[model samples]
Target: MQYLHAAISETLRLYPPDTKACRVDDIMPDGTEYSPERWLEYGTCRQENPFRFPVFHAGPRMCLGKDMAYVQMKSIAASVIERFEMNVVAKDTCPGICPR
Candidate 1:
């Protein structure tokens, strides 16, 4: 179960369902340039979604299924791996080229 949780976490880290997020310019600080382009960073995770594009619903109206999604992914993946010995069909292929 521990390993299953770890694997599921890793999967989500690598391939997040919603790629990026965005927020509006709520506070336009003085003496700073306010560009709409600057709204990129808030929605993206530093390592995961570096591009800061709109993959998930941005702003206060975000995805309500965040927790549910995580739970389902972990449960389904753990069950499958625990029940059977599964392996990738093309063993020689690099995971970088495919969905890890």
Candidate 2:
């Protein structure tokens, strides 16, 4: 469960919903890269200032339901994953029927 959250956070860290929206009060540009490990060391999802990863927007222009949205997303992902199993297919394998 923890790793799932970290993976999602890392995804957002690299590709934020809004990549460019100007600055609100001089933010340090040090979080442009994806680092899932950060979530283990620090609860960036629950802690830290929102400015560090403002995917929902910034300052007064930010989304009011941001927190709720995350909760809903996680819930849906967990439920879906629990209901289904995902597998990795080898690149060399043929997916279609091999008629002899």
Candidate 3:
């Protein structure tokens, strides 16, 4: 479970799906407006690629597969790293994929 969590954490650290999420619909009794701008700015900082953030599909209807996704990714990554110490053979500055 720890390994799984680690893998998911790493993936999320890199490719966060939503990147940023905001309350599109106001559900508050006070009709408070959710400033998407604020969330975007916060998300940008939180979006420290190669680092983790808190925008893991937050809200009342967030993703339920969050844990599962993390576990699966971790297991696969752990297995690969355990057996091999691989390196990328990129020829250009942009290796196409993020150099994670």
Candidates in order, TM-scores: namely 0.34, 0.53, 0.37
Score candidate 1 by lDDT.
Answer: 0.47
**Candidate 2: Cα lDDT at 57:** 66
Give the true-structure RMSD of model 3.
12.8
Ten contiguous residues minimizing lDDT sum, candidate 3: 38-47
RMSD of each: 13.8, 11.7, 12.8
Question: Which residue pairs show backbone clashes in model 2?
Answer: none
Candidate order by lDDT, decreasing, is 2, 3, 1
What TM-score does candidate 2 reach? 0.53
User: Highest lDDT: which candidate?
Assistant: 2
lDDT by residue (tens digit), candidate 1, 1-100: 3334444444543355663534764343553342232222333212223235323445576567755875787778767768986777898865322234
Off by over 4 Å in 3: 1-11, 18-55, 85-100
How do the residues 16-88 of candidate 2 rate in per-residue lDDT, one tens digit apiece? 6765755675445884556666665443334446688777767898889987877887898888888887776
In the range 1-100, model 3's lDDT, one tens digit per residue, is 4323433454554445664545694356756443323213322312223222554555565668866765666678778878987776775564122323
* lDDT of candidate model 3 versus the reference: 0.48
Q: Candidate 1, which ten residues in sequence have the lowest lDDT sum? A: 37-46
State the lDDT at 44 in candidate 3. Answer: 32
